[model samples]
Target: MPNTRWTIVTGASSGIGAEIARQFSAIGHNLVLVARRREKMEALAAELTAADRGFVEIVELDLAEPDAPAKLHAQVTQMGLGVHTLVNNAGFGLRGEFVDLGLEEQVTMIELNVTALTRLSRLFLPDLIKRGQGGILNVSSLAAFQAGPHMAVYHATKAYVLSLSEALHEEAKPFGVTVTALCPGATESEFGARAGMEGSRLFSRARMDAARVAKIGVEAYRAGHAVSTPGTRNKLVKALGRVLPRSVMRKAAGEMVG
Candidate 1:
């Protein structure tokens, strides 16, 4: 039987997003997986189906495109899938000085990380409020809590996500909807290589597993927590940012990225 409600996970082809989909499916939530790679999503769908996890739907899309959000919503509606959860996980980061990075790439990053996330949240929020019980899980980063010198735009985007999610959490309380920001530190994933941060000190240090991080994030969403940082070390790092001076934090961040 088809699940009555669906959890939509963007960037579902790999990394944390992929793990989140698996965990959600394991918990018997029907899924709508969206990503730019159709073949990858199709493979995931097949695996989930073979396991009889739940009904899995794949929507291959590049959400960075201006019309993608509306088109995605339309596809879900057309498929008669009522969205019970939205995971805005489709974003990437670039490790470079802001001025040295390609202008087009930075703009596209903003489009994906900030614009797409905000648009999807707004597009789905009305329905979630009407249902009065759904949730939004935004995958931010530990970078959200501090300023990053080399990856300035990426850090800013995550900060936006953290801020937006917290405010939405408060606003949605009366409606019984939960909004959570999952802030994970450097994890074992493709992110480092893709972002050109593979050789950075941060990635060289200890990292958490994507599956573990995803499990923690999913559990936090289920518990209606406003923000969740997976590893104990990550939590401590985030806490330390509170007492550290802005100059010190910036210097530390710059050194890590270097």
Candidate 2:
């Protein structure tokens, strides 16, 4: 049994999730790095262990599976590991009109983004309550604030995450559980490529850096903030979404993402 406080970071094989795991490692937190790519996670564990003298457990998982959370809970329980933090960062995007994208892709997105996140949070909340202190960081997106035409389903999933995280923040306050929604803008990663936007100049022009995004997410969660938008531009976009009419916001988002 691992007796130390454990921070579980999903999608930790690469990109933002990897950076988040790295940040947690720097602070001496033992990790359970979850991803579908076992080799990548093992490599990350090796690097973090060597560099920071930190401990990391690699779990090759596909969060899109409905039974993943339950399996994860059982594994952690069997190991007698105490989870102090959970970062729900395993999600992807599909870039196309709703009618143009295949139904399976959208379903997979929902499975990973909404169902997996909700289940993990619910599964871990009780333990955190018993311990009287813990944190949950949900990785949403700046698109969560508005309706995106090209990324409708993905944006909608993130909106659910943001709303759910905000509500959880309030509900968990008395229980000493902090919930934070990390709303990052277009990040410099292979996400755009995977989403079929590899040639997008707009994506390339965006200012988000994965490391900075991870830092902001961890800092916000530690500070007990309910929401964290990494970049100033993203912050402004959030504010605008709040102030603008829903129709106008939707149109603007469509233009930007389309």
Top model by TM-score, which number? 1
Clash counts per candidate, in order, are 0, 0
- Model 2: per-residue Cα lDDT over 131-175, one tens digit each: 989879999999888888888999899999999999999999998
Instruction: Return the TM-score for each candidate structure.
Output: 0.98, 0.96
Highest lDDT scorer: 1
Which tens-of-lDDT digit does each residue in 150-204 have in candidate 1? 9999999999999999999999979999999999999998899989999999999
Q: List the residue pairs that clash in candidate 1.
A: none
lDDT of candidate 1 at residue 228, scale 0 to 100: 97
RMSD of each: 0.8, 1.6
Question: Any residue pairs clashing in model 2, and if so which?
Answer: none
- Candidate lDDT values, in order: 0.94, 0.89
Worst 10 residues of 1 by lDDT: 1-10
